[model samples]
Target: MNVPELFEEGWYWTSTQYSPNLAWSQSFDDGLQGNLVKDYEGRVRVVRRFPLN
Candidate 1:
């Protein structure tokens, strides 16, 4: 998959929940996966999956 033109360099929330107060996040800048507080400000990317038939 290719990165979108409007991609921003920062941490983005994932669907995975790390804990009651933390969640999984990914960094677009360096492709790092980490956890961040639920209340912290972050970016999000809306995407959909398609079958490779």
Candidate 2:
């Protein structure tokens, strides 16, 4: 997702499903070093350091 230059934050949505027959669960990396940040309202505000480079 592309954010405006004026903002230091961005957002997006995703969906996935898992199969019960699979021996291992799906896993991936965003190359970030931090956990998800949340607002006072308990909504996700930022996903820390999702490195693309």
Candidate 3:
């Protein structure tokens, strides 16, 4: 098993959208998660896992 290396932590977006003007995000720094406005500045990290066939 291998662990991914993480650099400077930042907030990441979530699919859990709040209303039409807000969205949910997670902070990798302290695991601080909250709902923030869409305009709030944040970093986006996307990943996918493939199953062995």
Each prediction's TM-score versus the true structure: 0.81, 0.15, 0.69
Candidate 2 off by > 4 Å:
4-13, 21-53
Q: What is the lDDT of residue 50 in candidate 1?
A: 80
Candidate 3's displacement at residue 9, Å, is: 1.5
lDDT scores in order: 0.89, 0.29, 0.79
**Collision count of model 1:** 0
lDDT of 3 by residue, 9-31 (tens): 88888878988999998888787
**Best candidate (score: lDDT):** 1
lDDT of 2 by residue, 1-53 (tens): 56445333333221222233222111122322222223212112344557687
Superposed by TM-score, candidate 1 places the C-alpha of residue 38 at a distance from the truth, in angstroms, of 0.8
| Candidate 3 backbone collisions, by pair | none
| Model 2: residue 22 alpha-carbon error in angstroms | 8.7
Looking at model 1, which ten-residue stretch has the lowest summed lDDT? Answer: 1-10
All candidates: CA RMSD (Å): 1.5, 11.1, 3.0
Residue 50 Cα positional deviation in candidate 1, in Å, after optimal superposition: 1.8
The per-candidate count of clashes, in order, stands at: 0, 0, 0
As a whole number from 0 to 100, the lDDT of residue 8 in candidate 3 is 50
